[model samples]
Target: MSKKRNLRPEEIAMLQANACMADNWSSVFVPENFDIKYVSHTRFSGEVTLGAFNKEFILPGGLKKHAGLRHVTLHNCRLGDNCLIENVQNYIANYDIGENCIIQHVNVILVDGVSSFGNGTLVSVLNETGGREVPIYDWLPAPLAYVITLYRHRPQLISRISKLIESYSKEISSSRGSIGNNSRITNTGTIRNVRIGSYATIENCTRLENGSVNSREEEPVYVGDSVIAQDFILSAGVILSDAAKIVRCFVGQACHITHNFSAHDSLLFSNCAFENGEACAIFAGPFTVSMHKSSLLIAGMYSFLNAGSGSNQSNHMYKLGPIHQGIVERGSKTTSDSYILWPARVGAFSLVMGRHYHHCDTSDMPFSYLIEKDDETYLVPGVNLRSVGTIRDAQKWPKRDKRKAGLQLDPINYNLLSPYTISKMRKAVEVLKNLQALVGETSEIYYYQNTRIKGSSLRNGLALYGKAINKFLGNSLIKRLEGTAFSSIEEIWAQLQPTESRGKGEWIDLSGMIAPQEVIENLLRSIEAGEITSLEEISAIILDIQKHYYEMEWTWAYDMIESVYGVNLQTITAKELIALTEIWKESVVSLDELLYADAKKEFSLTSKIGFGVDGSATEKMKDFEGVRGDFENNPFVLAVKDHIVKKEALGNELIERLKVIL
Candidate 1:
């Protein structure tokens, strides 16, 4: 909207002739060249500004509509250039609409009194009864929300951050709402105090009140038919369609909540999809998807999670008043009809099958499974390490991300084998070894935190953990040492030296980002000490950390190199390096072999049972091959086989380079 001049006497008579009524005709101002012919049956009151109507909009299917104001009532509104505002059933009041907007057939759209436009809305995530209330703002990122919701021990830190958000909300609070350029609001019911952004598409929505559709030209937000969102911050590229209702939530970039999905007091981050399900007080991190109507995700914190049909949790207990919460760590999956009593913690990339009455905590274990047998939970630790599904998930996450580059709010690190998970694996190995030592290594009934583990499973868990550690450390080592000539052991040691000192401690996953715990703590301390002032500063720091991930990752990996392999870095020899490389190659090959076998099982005869439903066994085999492809030629299978070969060749090349020192 720009400066406007009052209408001339002839123009006023023209408007009067066109049946346009104004409470104060002197208060109505229009831009130069704003034709009176384009304004008809429009009622204006109290300082309304109207732009020139010189453009025509060619809608989808070639339906053309000239930019004009018809049958619309504007109260203290500023209409931008070339906007087509018609058929406002009630009115559009106290708003500054931007250029090229379309407001058609909408009911009441007004900013009543003071409003923050969904900023400072408290989302009681991971607990319905309001213990962890995350204040959502327009720029709320995943890592910041993670700390605010989970780090309750630091009350002062939370208070400082909360105050920052409150100050920000107050700063941006206004008596008038905004509709950015090229935004479209059509066939809507009511839009009260909602801040719509550039290129936003809001059509046939029942209601959108006190929310911020933070859309942009790069990727627009879409609100479809029968959708209702209140006190929410829907980020760029978000889609709320098909009766999707979100209350007091902050939906991050590229999230899709459609098909009658209901979410309340939840924070759904980037790339999350919720269709036909219900989310209550959950901190749904990046890639958390629940597509079944029967699925109820409540009082839980999850990342990279896939909740199966009828998969649910019990947050209420007879003793406590729905106070319990759970965490299904990143990359975890729940089977259909699975149930977990609250206060359980599933490990990263683990699978949960069947109901478990006993609460289990497997945070120290990264890739495992919890299965029920005879009403008791049986733990298969580190089994997902060799799972074909796990590998495919790790491969597909980066590809599945649909958020455009400019609108990426979540600082996502798609590494399944980061220092965060490897550190958990290290602790798991210690816990497993401690259990084995206490219960005799041959014992069948090994108990760990409300679950039973068999001896064979225990042994396999240790071996798998060891292999994964080797693979991660070797990967880090290669990444650090590659493409550089090492003339001596000193040179190799120099290359392996940590560049940054901050990554030498335990690493934690902040919903999507994996960074050193001390680094995050230092950031919190800065907030607590009032060193860090704004939310933008916090987001910038977190994104910078995400960019420098591999640099910091190598620092963490370097610290573990000596302790895990029992090698002295100061006096390291070429032969020892060669040995380490050989061990890495073996681990890599063995893991690939396990993956190969796991993929082969999917192409087995039993897996082909229903492939050729009306044909013989031979036809079944042929049809299975046709549909699922032969195992050796399948994409994942080929990748696995190629991974083994590439790793082996790289290790051999490194060993050959080391042999030159002999």
Candidate 2:
């Protein structure tokens, strides 16, 4: 609370001579060191509190303006020390402007009545007709939102979580807004019921209403150039600029939205990027990106996805409203001009090309390709396991993360081959084998899940899924016994035993965080029982699950190894372990060879067509080499070669160690 004091006689004389007027001079209060010369042509109404103006601010292009209040109208506001307020077209009311802040050319910054500042705003994500409404609030984690949006089966849990968020909204509701210290609001228009944080920059924005910018000194939020946002919460390190329009959204940490991109009723989590496209009623998980003008993502759930130009989806059948939704699982891609009807579920790490009207569900078979030919959907399962683009995407997502400083709300796991996907591969192998058995071996085409699979594709898919499952199980085994030296069968069994027993059943990818399903069920039960009632407690529980991922993962991998390989670890010998290591080495080397061959296709002569236009063949070859370097020396190619060598040496080392026990 600022102390109010009566003005001295000298101060009143100076104020009169400086052309400053107040409705009632007795209603205004100033600090002891306030100077009347710095305040001119300013009108004060209602009860105003003024602070000292002692410093000068250096604007852009080296122009300087001393800290003062000039040509402005302030009502029931508090001005902090060394702040500059100039050229307010209208007035600033009911705001506590902080120290060293700059407010110039702003119109009407106020809180009309009471506002919750975008908390408790129900955003209908994933489904437009509204069973999956997530009441967004500050500090809403992706895992928590996942539960709120998808877990409708547990009504008691959802009710308890909603009540907690509503209670938090009521606790922070206020009638007076605030602009924090060292912030800048220049050339913006109409900010209402918004809370600005320290070190934030709001420039040339058209309008902002009912929101909170959670910026800080470490990482400031930037809202630039004609952006209009309503009922939104922009998290720390976020940048929304270039005429973007957002409504009823929560933009999470380090997200970049610009170049006229518009989003409505969406929830984009940490590290996502959107530009030149439009998103509606979508739940974008970590690292989701869409950067083309013709792309439209509507009524879908996606994560680690890349949308190409002219990619689209239809959520309505023309008979009903936009009520259907789709799920493109993690690490998927859509090629240019591709389309899918809603109520479909695309498998993880897959690619979609062409247009298909039939709704398909391929959740059991991951890493496949869905291509439309002659209006028929063709499913090629497990072929993406050898694509170079998949490998590159997995490698680049962690490097491209832009969240340098902030408390990250999403717990992201950036593994291309985890227990989640590997389990799907195991199921895929079983499905392919079953299809071959049910249909005769001479059958040319087999149909499953509203798609056609060629006979050749089924055999190749079985081979690919087999190799991948072997690789994942072997990787886990080697990691578990990497450093230990076993001299006897009992010693080998002891080393192979799992450290924990919690991850034996199904595992799920909750947006970005991957964990056991049983663990999530236990948390839901606790929430329904009222033992976990606060957002902080829920976040802590999620963090604990992430922290113990490896321990739980090992428990699951041990069971998988026994079930897939038919190896009884309790009675296994050193010779059997050595044979398994050899098989692991073969699988690793085979996959690397396939990736190497796939990379070579990019450097072929057919890819060098337009490199050297109107030139000889020699010149074209030279031009192609200059732009796209030789395949042998490319960075990704070199990494692949190095990976093969390292894996071979590791497998050889482990086999040699096991030979001693024999």
Candidate 3:
């Protein structure tokens, strides 16, 4: 607590000489060593508390100015030590400015009345017509928000979650806002009820109203030129700049929205980047990126997605308002000029190309391609299993994670071959085989779920799905038995038993989290029963599920192995295990070979056409190699070859060790 003392006669004379005036000098409190030398042309009204301003701030381009109040009007404001507030256009009212902050050339910053600072604001996400409104707070996790948006069948759960957030909002509601320490607000206009955090830089923002910029010393938030954000919560490590317009949104940690990107009623989770695009009522999960000017993502749910130029979606049909929504599962990509009508669901790791007006649901066919030709939707199932782009995307997401500080609220599982996708692949294998059996293998075109599958595509899909399934199961098996020693069949069976049975049936990718369906169901049940009451509790539960993912995945994989291979683990011998190892090796090598060939396509003669415009074929080859490097030495190609060698050696070693047990 700072003490209020009367200004000395000499100090009052100096302040008056400096053109500083106070409505009531007795009502203002200043430190004993406070100097009126640097403070001038300032008017103070109501209650004002001032701290010592002795430090000098160095500005850009080698200019320096001492920290003090100059040419500003303060109304019931408290200025901390070593802060500079100069050239306020309107006034700053009811703000507790922190130490070492610089508020210069601001139009008006005030808290007019009690404000929740964007908390408890209902953002109508997913479905734009209402009903899926999530009351966003600072700590809203993706999984919790996922439940709130999708689990509307459980009304009690929704009510409980809403009340929890609302209660938290009420607790933090205040009539006076605060600017944190080491923050800088320069050339900003009309910042109303915005609670900025420490080390934040708000520079040249057009308008920021009713939001919480949750910046911190470790990862400061940056709000730059021409940005307009309202009813939003910008999380730590977020950068909203370059005329970005955000409304009724929650921009999560490490998210960068720039280049005139517009987002409304959206929740963009950690590590997502939006540049020159527009998003409305979207639930963009971790690593969702859109970097094109013509991209419009609306009323959709996506995670680990990459939207190319002119990629858009239509949520409104003609009858109802913008009420429909779509879900593109994790690791999907929309090629240039791709569009999808609402109420569609794309499976994980799929590629969508061309416009599709039909609301096709390809949720069971993971790693496929949905193409449009002459107003017909063509589905090529499981071909993305061998796509170099899919492999590159999976390899890049972990390296591209930009959340360097703060607790990551969204639990992202960056596995390219998780049980979620493997389960879908298994279903796809069954679906394709069933389609062939029912429609006859001689049929040229087979129809399933509003999409046409060619006969060759069906056969190729079945083969690709088989290879991927074998790779995933073998990977899980090798990991499970990596260091275990089994001398007998009983020993092997004991080691192969699942650690838990809860992960046997189904799995789901809840935004970015990959978990067993049973576990999610259990958590939802707990929420419905009021066992989970707060946001923190729900987040803890979701993180716990993420923590034990591998163990639960083994549980799911063990059952899948037995079902797929027709093996009775209780009676299987070392010879069977060795055979499984051989199959695993073959699958691993085959997929690696496919990836290698795919990489080679990038270095082909056709790829060298534009490299050497005025040179011969030899010069074009040289130029292409100079830019893209040799195919054998490329990082991805080398990694693919290395993976093949390591997996073969591993499988051989495992087979030999199993033979010893026999």
Candidate 4:
């Protein structure tokens, strides 16, 4: 923004000789030391201000292009210093191009009237008919969106939030667009009413209108060849390339949508990957991934989900139009070709295989398997508790987090065992025992929630749920006093008390955040009462929930253990603690052994059939070993064995320490 002056008579003569034409010479302004040698064959109309163009840009192979305007038309625009603009088919209008930017061979870039760059756009997520529309803004996080989209019972809260977002959108609305500094746009197509962020790359895009690429210096947004996005807000570190197209979507930080994937009316959060698939009216939470071309995610709410190839769902089974929506809890997976009719609920960490049409609800049965047996939906509860795949997924999510830079919008909880899942496990135990009691224990099959359970499956479920409960409670107890030194049994009893006021009553998973329901309700009440006004306050509270997860977890576990086993934390004896620790140690070792057996299945003879390629059995085994490694030395197997020893030692050490103070 240096001091601008009218073009001198000598500069006007030089520009006329160089084939540059301006409707009114007085309307064109430049800096005191603006160079005129680089302005040629360019048409300027309306008010135009030019900056110094003294630098040359070096291309990939060292070809240099001097910074200047050539073969282009500009209207009512302000050009920054050292910007090279060339080969624009249509005129650039109502824009402020930043310094050190290169715009080449673009079809057009303009702003038509006042634009908000896609903010305050309502995306019909979860239900396309408009009952569950979420107003998308630049700062919309998953927790806030989860509340706004799903908490429609409170109309005032929704209306207030919608108004807040509309106000924000109007605050940023402008009649002109801007390209941030150090950005590169080459071989692109139409870009209208889009605000590009710093260091963003837009190359070979077909059409991008009414969007905001909220890129940053550390995490730049990238839109590559053949991409077309409209009415979208792309957070930082997003990679949308390879002909992918999205409309009416709010893509969160570090998400990847590539390989011709198409998404419409969806809200996708961080670290999610939608490749070669299609999504419609879905609320995809953190790490919800679908990597196959045949996968279609429609009218469902998913978090930490992995949809296998050919996985799909039916939303319009009723006479009414597609009004039914389903909720797949966190950490669930669908096997290949698996399908579920809408209005169903899949439990957290559950696995769904085959097709289900009974509209089963397994929200009270976490870590189970839902399979169609003889075309009847069969539920095997607590089976995924022993799955190595489940453990690996939980371990890999934190490591695979791509939001290494930028403001993380989603606060993800990566724990495999938490109060959220454990409460469901406790309820599952009751549901299984009640089923056994109601329908005699020897029955071949039992029914609950429109799904059948085998007699043996129910028995095994009770045992597994009991063991899992013991393990979780004991783990919480040990964690609360892991490094603290206790002098007497009285001190141990005092330490068992909850330090936080939250975590009592119900616990829930708000997309990726695991928090006590009481606290969440309080937050909503605050919103209802106008105590919480701004989006920043909500975000700050959301972060505080994650920041103090362990403290809140202990409070829930303390009450749950008392309710399950009648072990009162107030007057619990050392002997009772020793017994509980023994039970926990056994459960931990038993589950690890099951995992070890499951890992052995991967290296069995049947698994080696295709490895040798026309060879003997010995060769087949050797080939399998060479490629997949020996089972005994496998990383997961070794880890499981190590886990057994470590749990045993921890239990023994705690017992001995308790004995010292007995």
Candidate 5:
């Protein structure tokens, strides 16, 4: 503890005159050489520390306001230097207001009782009824929440993790809250049990209760006019403005919630933007965005997902309550007005373009299209591999990461095709082949899970799925030997040796972080045994596992080759490698061609119809060129063309090298 100081005679007189009554007036200390010129109309009680306030503060638009109290009541609060706190409608209590903070026109600010600022608040995330409630904290990341929300089958593990958080929250619980340095709170209605971080800008917010704003200088969080939040943790770089209502939520880093968007019991991760929509009991992973006004995301798990206008889900049947939940994997999208009845699983990087009554489990067939045809759902598997939209989305997500924190909490894996999704595709191919065998190959349409897969669609889907699998395997092989100079077959075999046995089985996508399932199990076992406790420690383990992903992936992929592709690697010939390379080259070129055609649609004549209004044909053409530019010259289009050329060259170069060895 620091030494206490005695108050001077004039300061004691001022303290006496202001009706300040502490254990001792001399105990109400200030910094040495503290100025008293700005001390006026203030009441202090209990053990209060006062910094000098005799400084002129510049107001907005060149106006100036002197630092002095006027018509405000404070109880057990410390006033920092140069702060302009005036006109409090009610009272400010149990707060340690930091230096240069401006509080004006606030109704009431109080700690009330011991509070952890929304820490350990139970958010019933995946299931609202109870069993999967995640105790939200200021540092809660998406991948950690994913484990807590979904891995409830391991009860001992969940209990140990929950115990760690509970103890952490207990340690930080206090009767006093802090409004951080340089914060400006004006025209706020009520702030109760909230811990505002440094440089936060809370202006005109109607109500803020039971939350922690984890703002910093590098990434200042903003809560603007008429915003209301309760039992929430607004992370660094978050902006909640324009009447957004958040309750029982964990808003992750760099998230933007505006335009009166409402969310309850949802965990929105990094870079998710929610505007004019509603989300309830949803687990929104990294980059899950919904911008339209009429969209509603409820009781689902999603990552890298975009909910189009009027996109909605139903978790209830008339027979039971809203008990069902769904998973829309990373890079998936729903078209305008698309709806899905819950207990459904949409695959990774898929496109859902229509309402589907039947609960289709497309988890095994990623990169597919779910379309409605004549009130029946049509499943075109693996078609999204060629979609320009998928390619564009993949290209943009990395560039769009808005997190500015030096310590990133979420370990994101952005691979479009990894062992996680490739394994699913391998299963899907078998499932489709089984369907074709069960129902005669000449059947006009085959039925599975109450959806129709037409004969031609099935055939094409099989071909596309095969191409994708071959591309992934070949790409993995090339990447594994990218820098190695294998002069002999023995050297090539040596390069393929497994470095670790950890990745030998299934792979799982825990929201955005993909790793081998065995690794996750190992983590869970460790958590159950109380080996990893801190949030930072848990995140470090996850990142460490993700760093060794490729080695584990090869372990899984090596076993998959014999079972799925019907190839034994121990007895493989040079001709098989050449054949696989040729097939991979074809797949890459075909998909690039498909993407090129799809991209061209963006700059088509129809796209230019509205660009040049009230102009002649040549003028309209010039106007279109000025704005949208020519199709072939577009940067993405050019990149696609270049990618095709480069990939072809790479494949040919490898093939020529392989010929010398053969």
Candidate 6:
């Protein structure tokens, strides 16, 4: 859309004197405001547009490279205002380099044909053989990826969804790549068929081909030294550095892949980090961290997971290819040298510390420890309920979110005691009781699932489960009726009734999203019917579920309340409510006291041995105090102690308020 103008004959002659050549001189179009002082040694052809180049740029070490082209060839390209293109070993073809961009020392930057810039690229995730491929896009969230990749049982729904993504990819396909305003690409190897966003810094990258760096002025993208990525969509604020190699991966916002880590066919969502490790065909949800060089995560689904050194899982036996997959639920950790055979599910917040070949199913026993002794797997159920590390992990995850993207791709639930894990604990309690009842009480050991449980461990597990259940139910009741005035028994009962009935079924963790099964069914119905079109709308639905988790959780927990207490909640009296509240207070305080004692072990005398190097014993004590602070003054330890006092006050206050009606 331009008013036609003829170039002055003298000006055209001056341009030819500046070593500027073109295959067809009439095809080159320059704007009316363009100043050609810096146009030197440039060749243009095939409907090109040149912008005003009137600025001097100071390069590295204060060497000035003025705004123009030098020893570069452009074909079917648009050069915007104040851009400096120099030292291109090969030509940049079919591109629109934006204003104020500096493209130097690049081998080639071009687009061969119509491309979607990695959107809707079939990333063969979770299975290396291509049966399960997720169509990756710029707005692909983890929950949607989980449904698309894992919900293969409903083939029609997946097909319908895949067709939608394919249509979107076709709609966005283009033949030219773009470099946005104020971007910098220096000392890079090769960039092909990629869309670099504004203010992005691409330096020393070996190769970045067929990707979309969704960068912006607010949060730019950084592709650092020797990074090679292909068929990827890197969201804003992500760091790809340290020779990390990736293929067919979706690196979500604020994710870090560094230290020569190699990933293929994986979906790494927001805030996931991979350092010196390897991941293949894995679905890594938010906060999935693997820092050890020896760890390998392949064909597994994980969230809030920490893989220890030499932690591994076998997805294939000798009989078949890598077809098997496992689920390590959220907030789970593996100790050093832990291994698990595939097709097993570990419950939430559980710790796996040893190798197991029996394929033990510990999904019913959460917050437990699975250990290996003499080639036998021992299940110490509910041990994590008393461990200080579990509580610390719950406290730390919320503080560690690093995503700066305006729209978060993962809706993370950081609750320590949700229906997802509490229901499992309730099942564990029943399982322990069943073992005790079926076998004689005098039995020294019992076998359940594939792991052995000693008598003492079973008893301790039952007790711990009871305490945890009481703690959770109490928390629900207190939160539901905290500020309400319960004048009589009927008022207290009315408060206990759920505000909504949507949560009265099984709960599930869809990658990072926690919601009821009915909601998931509704979402699938909508997707099948073409109601959910944009990926952002689907993400909105997931966030709505996460925000309403408590209301839905109450419905699920209420059904279990009647069975656990053996009382009808509708006719429960004020005295019963007060009693439940009292038991809750005791359970909460007891757990807090145990956590306080456990935290003291870290600051004991044994921990002081290495603190004071070349010092006396008294000096060692001082050194430990100075370095590690006093135990009572430690942040986590003090928080635990203060928690007991605060809960005691809250429980007594509630009891006092309820006693008046009783």
lDDT of 1 by residue, 1-662 (tens): 56789999999999989999999999999987778899999999888999989899998899999999999999999888999999999898999999999989999899999999999999999888887999999888999999999999999999999999999999999999999999999999999989999999999999999999999999899999999888999999999999999999999999999999999999999999999989999999999999998999999999999899999999897876889999999999999999999989999999999998898999898899999999999999999999999988888899989898764789998999999999999999999999988989889889999999999999999999999999999888777767776677778878778778678888999998999998898899999999999999999999888888888888888779989999877678888888888889889999999999999899877887778789988888889989888887998888888888888889888888777775
Ranking by lDDT: 1, 4, 3, 2, 6, 5
Record all residue pairs in model 5 with backbone atoms less than 3 Å apart, i.e. clashing.
none
Please state every model's RMSD to the true fold in angstroms: 1.1, 1.7, 1.5, 1.5, 2.5, 2.3
**TM-score for each predicted model, relative to the true structure:** 0.99, 0.97, 0.97, 0.97, 0.94, 0.95
**Clashes found in each candidate (C-alpha, N, C closer than 3 A):** 0, 0, 0, 0, 0, 0
Give candidate 5's error at residue 43 in angstroms. 1.1
Per TM-score, the best of the predicted structures is 1
- Comparing candidate 4 with candidate 6, which one achieves the higher TM-score? 4
Single out the weakest 10-residue window by summed lDDT for candidate 4: 478-487
lDDT of 3: 0.91
lDDT score at residue 491, model 6, on the 0-100 scale? 84
lDDT of 2 by residue, 550-641 (tens): 89998999988888888888788888888889889999999999999999999988998899898899999889989998899999999999
| Model 5 alpha-carbon miss at residue 207, Å | 0.9
> Candidate 1 regions off by >4 Å?
1-3
Cα-based lDDT at residue 584, candidate 3: 93
Candidate 2 positional error at 24, Å: 4.0
- Model 6 residue runs over 4 Å out of place are 1-8, 54-66, 486-495, 531-534, 567-569
Error of 5 at 130 (Å): 2.8
Off by over 4 Å in 5: 1-4, 14-27, 54-57, 65-70, 79-82, 561-576, 615-617, 656-662
Candidate 2 to native Cα RMSD, angstroms: 1.7
Error of 1 at 84 (Å): 0.3
Model 4, 1-662: lDDT tens digits are 78999999999999999999998989999999988999998899899999899899998799999999988899999988889999999989999988888999999999999999999899999888999899899988898899998999999988878877888899899998999888999999999999989889899999999999998778889999999999999999999999999999999989999999999999999999999999999999999999999999999999999999999998998679889999999999999999999989999999999999999999999999999977789999999988889999988999989886437889899988888888898889888888889999999999999999999998888888888888899898877656666788889988898999888988889899989999988888888888977877888899888889989999889988888779888999888888888888998899889889888888887888789898987888888889999999999999999999999999988888787777
Model 1 collision count: 0
